[model samples]
Target chain A: MAKKEWEKRIAFLGPEGTFTELATKELFPNDWTIPFKSIPECIEAVDAGQVDLAVVPVENALEGSVPLTIDYLFHEADLFISAEVLTPIEQNLMVHKNNVEKYEEIESVYSHPHALAQCHKYLYYHFKSVPLSQSSSTAAAAQFVAENPELCVAAIANVAAAEQYDLQIVQKNIHDFHFNHTRFFVLSKRNDRIERDEDKQQIKTTLMIKLPSDRSGALHQVLSVFAWRQINLSKIESRPLKTGLGDYFFIVELLEDENAPLMRGAMEELRTLGCSVKSLGSYYTYHQK
Target chain B: MAKKEWEKRIAFLGPEGTFTELATKELFPNDWTIPFKSIPECIEAVDAGQVDLAVVPVENALEGSVPLTIDYLFHEADLFISAEVLTPIEQNLMVHKNNVEKYEEIESVYSHPHALAQCHKYLYYHFKSVPLSQSSSTAAAAQFVAENPELCVAAIANVAAAEQYDLQIVQKNIHDFHFNHTRFFVLSKRNDRIERDEDKQQIKTTLMIKLPSDRSGALHQVLSVFAWRQINLSKIESRPLKTGLGDYFFIVELLEDENAPLMRGAMEELRTLGCSVKSLGSYYTYHQK
Candidate 1:
């Protein structure tokens, strides 16, 4: 209940129509939210007390971990995840209201490269011979297509963005995978820990660590503590330590109770491994829609 | 000997005027080249025999790996890397040649989202009070800025793109990292690998694999082969196997010699791990003016 003691102003990466805005809204409905232009800024705001909490996109199913978000989380201190949100995304095929051509006559497809990528299958099947132009974002693409009547291009954007651009939807749900969800974490400056909630089935603690150099079986030795304790790992990703090419930093999510016997044993073993370790925070994912 | 072989058709990701186009010209000087809209299509062209070779972006110092390119390499068959190029990147902020003001006075700033991300520092410093917009590519962003002269907007683009759009460089070298370089790989359906010349100093091989399930020490155990062989890993990443969460498909890169004894032993031990393994190819990066 420390959350109530704090005002809990949540900060996120955004400009209102961005996906991070959507993710942040999904987590804290009533909390005051501020938008930052970059992940580092969001983290900095949390650290500097400009905001009480921060939400950052960590990974996407198709694109892997967002590297900048990973880097900031790895280096940031005095901040920990207060909660998490998994958002299932549906990107639309958006075009300007002025365009009045059938899908077959469309000459080009425009979107942010990532949006273009997410809709690769649809473009390949329908517009295999047509040109695909990259815009800065789906919203920008729509704005571009709005002005370039000569381009006859459609952009892959969100329904909200389509509405914002007054664009029509030519097609929808074009991503290759049906379950396209992004995992986001809410960060807090305060060190208040999460109380175990019985309603949630999957409990995950997200952490970052650096292992010793010139060592063999170092990571294995770290993992064994968890496996022996019967704790399951939800995810593990390694980033360059940023010190050099050969060095690395790892982010892991453990699926176990913080106070569980096996988990405590695992943490002890991890500390014994003699590496720089920091607990980002623990949160649960609720499968119920 | 392949270098002396007649001629080869190379595919690159471009419509011309892209960083990929510039890198392609460097890799294949005056060779018959076909440009594809995306990296996947370029690889598909090589796989489908439409072209003998293709070039794709591998990793960026600022953005880490291009996940689709790696995932595509993981799934590609009968292909090998012939060479690589690391191009230094310099991002520029541009606007319509007409209006000028601090970024705060502007309503929007356009660029490829990646470009936006690279110049995020500058944008945050200047445009935190304004709106930031993203287009599909830097070129598109420049073009958007060119057309929207009446709107107080700017874009993060490249010098070449600024020239193409007839926009002025509002700022240059806006990326947070000064040593930003994107590594590109030249791939071929033919097996003619590069013979190390005096210019070559180091070699890297791209590898894809699946780690055994619930095996505590599996990845560490597998890495031992490389460590024992003194092989330095260049990169390692994991994508979900897509069977479900908790399962992963991993991609790794490490140094290699065509006939090194330790390298051979490492490959053998890696095979014994009972995982899906694919080698993209081996190549070296050399300095270029």
Candidate 2:
């Protein structure tokens, strides 16, 4: 049910060699994937029809949700997630190829803040006197290090980024844990459901729900609907509504195939509670080796 | 009663003029306040007894919990929260006073990423072509602009920060939402129960909960105890366990003073459910005029 050739262009968070780019390459290895500096820009490009799809990291195994991605999809972007891709992440510290004693001579480290957080333990001990400068993305930092050629300046990115920028790795696997991974949402203007083989591809339906205000036990009742219906919830995220201190809205991902009958029933039950629901989309989550 | 004529030291998110520093100044005007680069460093210094108290931002009405602050308190720090300060935020864009033709000469804008996000509308419409750079703190950005004297660089901070950094306010009230307020926690190594007037100062108990893996509706049940006990929850935050995808631990703040008998029973009930609970501390929330 898939074609071999198409002039489809995808946009990912990058300059190059970001985890989003890795996910994009895994899913559409033959398609052209461009990089955007920001998540909103990448998404808006898809909505404006400049790209066939926007690959953006939505969640991390270690860091929970990426706030920018979640906020964009929930309140700003009109695009839908056509697919989700998960990539195992390995963060490395790379420096200019000409630099000798990279780690010993480093005065400052550059990376996306999230990357810095992931490598906190390493950075705190290793770069004791160094300041961590923020970059737009990990790859962008690598690109900067490649261009600057400073022994005192280094970046925490990926192996692909090292290759892309022709930088040399001073340290490998600098991330906190070995089980690090990130989930990327393939956003598209058209969210038509694709035919899936049941066992081969499992469908996941992600929805954003605004819990009814001024009600006690509203959230409990909302969860009860799915719990009683035996709909397995893969994830539930509560974000501030911003109206007040206690207000919150939840985003849930239900593990089910397309047009899941029980999910529809749960949605109906949620509506009865006056909860507003937006279906992010139903798609086969792509699992990469 | 606390002593009147002693040297009190306070640590805050710094290098100066940050909202946390403002909270610190408001709470301890006559005391010595120092700036630490990160929340962990500030809190750690307090825990290590280097400082009497650490003022850190815990929650924002608009953006929800500060993950670094929450996670640091929950998993790492052994400190107790002594007071909560709520400050209505006013984000201002500031630049060097000598700079002229600000908008046309802009190359890169600077601020804490959250500040940039808060003023998205203003930044997008005004500096569409300019790239947004992240700084350690909004005040740090303002200080950078003040020191650099670069016509292209500006920062989003508060009026207090603008004055401290000797930067001119380019725009006032640039924050998207006027109701935005951040809740700051004044953390101390000592969790002493101070006598409260109750009428003037409300007691707030914050706890961390780890739901049992064996129980399906453990969280719902946990809420039921609160809902039944009529203990109001001021906030609920879920952070990653960092073990795997879909694993989380929740931090909740109950709108009640320390050692409420009903909350004790609720904690016992939670223990029966095999859920682990830790009381971070109960304190009278401080409000600044």
Best by DockQ: 2
Best by TM-score: 2
The list of candidate 1 runs beyond 4 A from truth reads A1-45, A48-52, A87-176, A193-196, A211-231, A240-247, A256-274, B1-5, B15-35, B75-78, B90-176, B213-216, B228-230, B258-272
Q: Write the per-residue lDDT of candidate 2 for residues A1-289, one digit (tens) a residue.
A: 3433775888998878887888888887788888898899999999899888999988887767887788778778787788888788889988887874645778789998889988999988888778889987899899888889744689999988999999889889989888888888999888765343542476888888897775766766777888777776767778877786657788888777537778778898899889999887888777766
Give Cα distance to truth, residue A277, candidate 2, Å.
1.1
Report the C-alpha displacement of residue B214, candidate 2, in angstroms: 5.9
Identify the CAPRI category of the predicted complex in candidate 1: incorrect
lDDT of 1 by residue, B1-289 (tens): 2443567788887655467756777756767867688888999998999888888887776556687787777655567888888777788877777775654477788777777777778878877766777676777777777877888888887777778778888777888767677778888876566554766768777777787666765666667667656677766677766544456777777777634778767777777886557666677774434
DockQ of 1: 0.19
Write down the TM-score for model 2: 0.87
- Model 2 agreement with the true structure over B141-233: per-residue lDDT tens digits: 988888898456888999888999898887899888878889899898888643435425768888888888836666667788788778877
**Which stretches of candidate 2 lie above 4 Å from their native place?**
A1-7, A93-110, A120-134, A148-155, A168-172, A193-202, B1-7, B93-110, B120-134, B145-155, B166-171, B193-202
Look at candidate 1 and tell me the lDDT of residue A149: 61
